[model samples]
Target chain A: MDYDYIDRLLERYWKCETSLKEESELRTFFSKSDMPKRFLPYKDLFVYQQIQKTVGLGSDFDVRVLSKIEPPVVKAKRLTMFVRIKPFLRAAAAVALIVLCGNITERSYFADDKLDYNYKDYKDTFHDPEVAYKKVSSALMMLSEEIKKSKSQHFPDSLYQNDLDSVCTK
Target chain B: MHEFSFQDDILPLKDKLFRLALRITMDRAEAEDVVEEAMVRVWEKRESYSNYDSVEAFCLVVTKNLALDMSQKKDAQNLSLDESMAESEMDESDPYHQLANNEKLKLIHRLINELPERQRLVMQLRDIEGESYKKIALVMNITEAQVKIDIFRARQKVKQRFLEIDGYGL
Candidate 1:
């Protein structure tokens, strides 16, 4: 078998001068048996390329990929299920939220009952106006005296401590 | 416009995408991830595929970009450099013929992997995948002339380096 044409084409192929069709012819020629020894160096490379084309994804790869990207027909069924219940689910959630808010408002209003009881006690005390006035005046005077006494005892110490703190911080 | 069927069209591309991804990243797992990602992307962008000239070319471009992006993001060294050497051990039964063939195959694989990025892709698309120059140009987003030049340079480099290795017994 004369490989002169193939050798010429192979040269052209190495130089990237061959067209696609010519390269295909070379590939076909190299793939067959009885390749001459002179071309042995280039034989394995082309054969390896032919084998490399067989390098592929596994048999299960399609199932794996399709499962991920394109949802199965069952997904459409699941979507239908979701579509049926979505409005009801929304309504239920809204109702639950409203109920929760109502309960919170009621609890807040009831929380002030202790303050109401304290107000009742004050109302009872102020029923006797003149006595209440004397009592309030006495209380006010006692608080004023207490404040004045504390100020005299601690104001100097606090002022000195503040100055120390400021100096230390700086 | 042709319809994009997962079973008929997209799923069949898994092998080609896997090979391209594997060629670039040189890690089987990473290549698998890249192909899966590419598959999902093609499915997601199925609507816009009508605008493209070729779906196969579009998918190849996507896979190449994704593989390159993955390598870039992880700062992955070209794992192909070391790994292809380890993978070329064929069956030991046919020692004389198989051993020489396997060594040459491994050397070829490593040499191809060592090619520059553009040339490697061009050679892969042209030689391994049996893609036309026009399709390769579309996938690589280069002119057909550039594709020709890249393939030429890549093939010559492989041939020269291969002969040198044989001569030096490396």
Candidate 2:
């Protein structure tokens, strides 16, 4: 029997020129028991690869891996419009409660007191314009005096200038 | 687009992923762990599966990365392929042929395992798994040229080593 085809294929295989199909053919040819004596040396290489193909994990491997892995995510239930908006609705309700409480507290603490005060009876203590003018002039004079006293206690400009001049000179 | 189901689409790829992980980690238990983690990761990103060109390629890439990480972390030792397992797979009736075939198989395994990591992985993906060069490139994050080069180098090395042993009766 002529092995010229297999020899040619094997040469191409070692050269990395064989197509996947041709390589499979070589594997098949080498797998048989009736190969010529000269081809026996190369037989083991192909046979070993064939055997390695069968080297795989046992059936239990699937169970082991599946147990470790999470199952495929179940398709999510279609949410109703209300269900989708529930979180936003809760937030809006919280905000509305806060605002309502704020309004109530403000009315309790401020509105009644403001309304009870009599704005209509708010008349000026000084009915005469001349007397009111004199009281205003006196208050202004006291304020002027206090301003003069504070000005007198201001940091001395001459002392500040001296410190500055000394530092510059140094 | 066909719907991607974890049970139908992804889980069936566990054996392929396991073989890839096993090739890298060189330890069955570690490879199993890597494959499990990879599956879980792919499941976690299931929503984005459609974004990828191929979910199978994506799973392979994930498994490769996890296996690399595990192997690196442990400084993967050169664990021999289980001989008993291979023996059980043999259906030979003659004891003489079985013994000789087993020795040859062992030699082939050692030759492959002795290859550099990238070459070993490329050969495994190309020869055993029958992956396309494009897919191997995607999984390994290398150019198709580089994948072919690695496969070529790996096959040549195995051939050279096997010839050296067989010729000298080592």
Candidate 3:
């Protein structure tokens, strides 16, 4: 191609007059092994473009990314299955705790259990160990309820964290 | 599908994206980061590939967007200079000519960086990407005519610099 024609196209190129096809044609024309001196300024751009087109991610990168995902959590994010449902599970657990703890002051279930432990006279006459066993169980239940309510009502806010912490702290 | 293999699709685009990112960022690491980010993004969004006009155009848009975003996020991230890529490229001219092209490319990158954001985008998409006007418009969220005008201004500014550097007095 004539330098003047190419130079004209390039002039149009920088001015946005060349169409995409025209622009590529200009690049292809200038990308030749030889070019007029006036056109030499543009050779790097096209040659660099041709080089760029052949570059690829090295296999090591693929290996690195695959290994990163092998720990299950990455897979969990990719699958979106567990992530999508995780919030609902946490919300359910939080609401359950709220309901259980919020009503702690009433001691509704403990009141009935406490009523049954008043059989101390019968226990003394019959010398039954079963009545003593029932009393111990009721007292343990009352203590656990108070502990749960205090923890839930205070700092253990996130339901998921609370569940994990409870299991871990033991 | 084999059509989207990293070697075929991504490697082929590396040199182009490297230069594109280099031109926009004027830094090799930033360019590399943009290219890698683009690759990972393409990998992640591969399932949605069928929806785009062409994967090449889609990838270019992604690359350009990431380069733009990275430039905006950190001034330091984009300040480094690019090394001479002249060793890998073919040139029939004297080594000085190659040197000139490299310098011009660096200068072009700087000039393009200072363009209005839209002009910079349109210039990169239309010129560097060799994208069709319609695709450039789509990527830029503008009309084809708007893409054309912005591209025109961008091209003109670069040509102005090119002419000045080459002493083309016109």
> Can you list each candidate's DockQ?
0.36, 0.42, 0.16
Model 3 C-alpha lDDT per residue in residues B1-170, reported as the tens digit of each score: 55556656655666566656655654555677788778778877877877567777677778878987887676565533332333213332533124436555545545666687778767665665567888877666679889888877776777667667656632
What fnat does each of the candidate structures reach?
A: 0.80, 0.88, 0.31
Predicted candidate 1 versus true structure: per-residue lDDT over A38-111, tens digit per residue: 88777777887888887777777777787897665653344688788999999999999999999999989898
Best-fitting candidate, measured by lDDT?
2
User: Measured with DockQ on alpha carbons, how good is candidate 3?
Assistant: 0.16
Itemize residue pairs with steric clashes in candidate 3. Answer: A14-B155, A52-B14, A52-B15, A52-B16, A53-B12, A54-B11, A54-B12, A55-B11, A56-B11
- Listed per model, the TM-scores of chain A against the true chain A are 0.41, 0.40, 0.34
Top DockQ prediction, candidate number = 2
Worst 10 residues of 3 chain A by lDDT: A68-77
Model 3 RMSD, rounded to 1 decimal: 22.9
User: What is the TM-score of model 1 when looking only at chain B?
Assistant: 0.84
- Which rank order by lDDT, best down to worst? 2, 1, 3
Q: Pick the candidate with the highest TM-score.
A: 1
lDDT of 1 at A123: 39
Better of 1 and 3 by lDDT: 1
